[model samples]
Target: MNTDESNNKGNIICGRCAYDANPRGATHCQKCGTPLVIASVPNSDPSPASDSTLLVGGISVVATVLFFAIGGYFFWQQVRVASTPSNLNNSADNISSDIRLYNSMKEVPKVPEGTFNYGGAVVFAPLRNSLHKAINQVYPKFGLRFTEPKYNNPGQNTGITMLLDGELSFAQSSKPLEDTHYSKAKERGFSLQQVAIGIDGFLLFTHPDVSIPGLAVEQVKDIFKGKITNWNQVGGPDLAITAFAFNPKFGSSLNILLGPELDQLSPKVQFMRDYTDGVRKVSSIRGALGIGSTGAILGQKSIRPLAIAHGNSKSYVPPFTDDGKQVNATALRDGTYPLTRRLFIVIRRDGTIDEAAGVAYTNLLLSQEGQQYIEKAGFVPIRN
Candidate 1:
């Protein structure tokens, strides 16, 4: 009914109470005391204050969308940072210091050449990067830019293997070239020169659960060859032995150890695939044993170093009694410890045996200052 007609009869509808109210904005209702106001339903949408609920709902949706977008961006950034280990500040600093040493070494009459790019894989060792960095900076001072190396898990001197394939100017390797590898270079109509850098050691590790008294050279080979497959055979625990060794391509220790000890590995050890897989499989095994560079086993508690020894003569000796702490470079070099290999920077002859960037870098590495980085990075220094 029309407001005017309804109001005159003293019957106004109360929207809130649904009671009949007196007409003309009465303070009290006629049928049931309730406030009277204008028409309950409006002709258009409600005013701003009255539509507050819908407005709040719209704002809430926008805020939720915005939050998700910001959250997603942060999550992606964290993943990126986690993956780039070489980009870390410490790694950069290590690179920079090596470069400085390279520059200083040139006072003895170094080459000044053009800017050129260089990089290649080195055998896995704590000092690998430092050695490379020292070389990289010096190469560039003579006008060569050393490209960052993308290290692959070791295989049989494939560091040089990559060089032959035209992937690198040189290959960094721990082991010397095999006859077959030399043949490949001969086939390519090029002579591969070996530049000796220094020596790097490999240490064997056992699970935190293992407690072997010590291991002799032959015992080590036996464990890896699958002949002695249980820790009890070596006095650790009564668990099966799962052995780990770096790939021959990236690391030469496997070949070094296998060659003299067993002549050639039983087909099982020779053909078994990749190095990373070996690390994974070995570390997870129940009573596992592993051999790797100091760099490779930094945080693993699952692997422990077993004592090694060689008698004053050629026969096997248990880890010796030194000044309480037993294993040292002497034992390793003497073959008392069993695992040892020489590391080097293998480069081609750009010039004479005396005049090349590679030769210049080799000399710098043996100097007192360059040897410091090598020592700090945790490797043996043949220089001093």
Candidate 2:
């Protein structure tokens, strides 16, 4: 029988005695007084030496050591980066002095007339777009007009900075304020704050080719890191499973939901280029698994939403209120669903008009009217 076919077969090769035997489950080798340990996958039958394996293994070892050296060089670069105050933060001198010099002339501030320049993540488009549309309809009586927002994808830090440095009057974001961003504004002598416009539920998604109704939390994690690369690994159809995620260049809500399941298997993961690519790969390949924020995936009929099975934690559940009025949501109050996260708007300490626009936009979004629009746009409201 093949060595792998035997459940407990092990081989220990001893340089001292040429002792090669199935030494599995033994405290010591039966034939020699050597400790027995499970070894890497080995050749079962006697075979000619593989020159390629010899060359490749030697190169691989040297490459690994060299790779770490390169990693150390990058680590040093990052440390230098982390230590230096970024232009957006700490370096007050970098921001235009006009920022500090602009006096708030109005005792009770009036909303600016003319088009207010705005930028935000793509995830906020539905809510923000609808709210902006409505704002123009009603707020025109108040002499307010908003330009259609220019935007970047969610969690893009640099884009936000670029938009703000220009004529942009306001900005929006789905992530929270960070120390660096705040430092930049404070250096500019600006006050900043963000609001929770609304809440969203991240859905555990699978290719429609996957027929399983749901996955346990751990199982979902196992699927994407390439560990459980077969449908049978997750109680589904017989198919090769490949976990798909967008490069973090795009914020991956999947990374947040998978959590320790990913962090624990740090060295095991291989990633693809982008989220759009992830979706495409999963849909084209049978039994592939992928995930995206509910905001991103909602209303895409081609994908399947998998209800998660999370044991009681924080009364959190999946598929919580599509409306925003419940004390306990079906998803959170119960342990039935799996993926969830809170997306927030961020601002710097400067509280520039950009922050003002975000705050204004959030106020409109959190209003009773806003929640209604959220559902219409296909997102679960945090409250309802």
Candidate 3:
């Protein structure tokens, strides 16, 4: 070997098996066959082979650092988005505030100045009276008036018929329009639209002489079905239980309370066409029991509302609660009390709505002031 080459070969050392150093130009240890490298020379430039290997390793390191940096940035962005607050609750609050403001200012008038005709369910008699009083008190100058509801015996069917026949401008119902009513109205080229105005809970009443404190839903069904013939069977006096009800075909509070069971009512249940007669029958007969709207039963001292349990539970809940002598408004509204029913104002779908008088009266019932009258008359106001 040349002298220069010999000097280069003398510089290499093996890191592994250090007992023997390799020749400076050798790539591996002579004794252990481990890879060897020359110690760095202070003033000399490295050979091209060493420079190429170091450049490839440096590039690999830079690429790995860039990949990690990009991954971390995307992960942080996703977390930031997930942590942001939502405005959904805020939007709901703003909407409620706007409604309150509109109601307070009377900024929007639902009806224009004009007279209108209306009729419907007899159950809405108290509500009609309240609406009449509200109009006289609040909008007396609007020249709007509602005729006392008529054709109210079997009120729902009667009112729907009247409205379709053009005898009434608008109708009120304690129940939604029945399928038969809809079909009849469609035949007459009109559709019925019902707007909810308030809520009423149907209450069961018994003569003061009857001593049962409360009853479960099933027990009530059994009593009306004549399975429990005597009051004693359901925890009352030994007298027979005389069940009074409206006509099976009539749409009344009793029909609502009984639901499909109305069709299955005991043949013994005496049917009346008028609720007033039913109430009187219940009061005069010592063993008589009846059901009617809470509003309708409020003032009669001869009968009392009986508490009802949910399903077969032992809990007894009254349809109405009074603090000493005043009605508990909150109790009626929260729906904790069962047997609640919705009352609706029915209008023609074919442009017959009284934009000024009809719409206004409807809106009045929905307003805060109007709801007060509804409550005063022994019905629960519809919640917004």
Who wins the TM-score comparison? 3
Taking the tens digit of each residue's C-alpha lDDT, what string does model 3 give over 4-49? 1112323444344352333334433333223232333233446754
Which lDDT values do the candidates have, in the order given? 0.49, 0.47, 0.59
For candidate 2, the lDDT comes to 0.47
- Tens-digit lDDT track for model 2 on 137-227? 6555322332332453334343357444543444455455455654454354443344444445555666887887567666666665556
For residues 55-166, could you state the per-residue lDDT of candidate 1 as single tens digits? 1112332453465466756643433442233322222111110122222454424554544333443333445566557655655555444444366543445556666655
Give the worst 10-residue stretch by lDDT in candidate 3: 89-98
Models 1 onward score TM values of: 0.57, 0.56, 0.66
Give me the runs in candidate 1 sitting further than 4 Å from their true place. Answer: 1-122, 131-156, 186-189, 260-283, 294-302, 311-327, 333-336, 350-355
